[model samples]
Target: MRSRYTAYVLGLEDYLLQTWHPDFRPVSLDLAENEQIKWLGLRVNQTALTSENTASVDFIARYKIRGKAERMHELSQFELIENHWYYLTGEMK
Candidate 1:
């Protein structure tokens, strides 16, 4: 999860897509204006795993855009496939 967050902070769209579940993968990722998005930090709020292959992590990411501050709380899901973790989906928390 931290790796994914690092990818996000660095605006590494390729890495993000590579780690995403194919079933939920998008056709493309466009970070055309990512330079304007400032990611401050991420805080893990909660984590739960029902088995060795699946898990959910709730996190709050702080950021700023234009002149306003914002925080996004999202519950992200992950699935382990062939011993590799893949991001499945997420819902706003």
Candidate 2:
């Protein structure tokens, strides 16, 4: 989760895509379109292992866009496949 947050902060779209589960990955995030966005920080509220190969992370990310401060709170799900973890999906909170 922290790595993904750093990916967004660095606008590393390719890296983000690589870590996302294919079933839920988008064709493009268009990070360049949001170049004005300034990421403040990330706070991981909690994490839990739902199963042997599945887990969830709840976090809050603070940022600024168009000079307006904002935050995103999400409960992100992940799956372990072939010894690698992939982001599966997330729910806005």
Candidate 3:
């Protein structure tokens, strides 16, 4: 999660795409010319075991970009694939 966050801050779009789940991957990303997103911090609210191979991580990612403040609070789903956690999707909170 943190690595992906840094990828966004550093304008590493390819890294972000690589980490995303296959089904949820975006076809393109218009990265900002100037890296303006100020990463405040991440607050991991909770984790729930949905099944033996699934889990949900609730978190708040705060930042400021393009002279505006934004916070993405999401309940993100993760699946254990090939002994690694793969991000699937999320419900915005």
- Which candidate number maximizes lDDT? 2
- Number of backbone-clashing residue pairs for each candidate, in the order shown: 0, 0, 0
Query: Per-residue lDDT tens digits of candidate 3, residues 5-68?
Result: 6787788999878777788889867777536678777888899989999899999998888778
Report clash pairs, candidate 1.
Answer: none
What range of 10 consecutive residues in model 1 has the weakest lDDT sum? Answer: 28-37
Residue range with the least summed lDDT across 10 consecutive positions in model 3: 28-37
List the global CA lDDT of all models: 0.90, 0.94, 0.83
lDDT by residue (tens digit), candidate 1, 2-59: 8998988888899999999999999878876767779999999999995889999999
In the range 52-93, model 2's lDDT, one tens digit per residue, is: 999999999999999899999999999999998899999999
TM-score of every prediction relative to native? 0.93, 0.95, 0.81
- Candidate 3: which stretches are off by over 4 Å? none
Local distance difference test, candidate 1: 0.90
Q: How many Å off is the CA of 51 in candidate 3?
A: 1.2
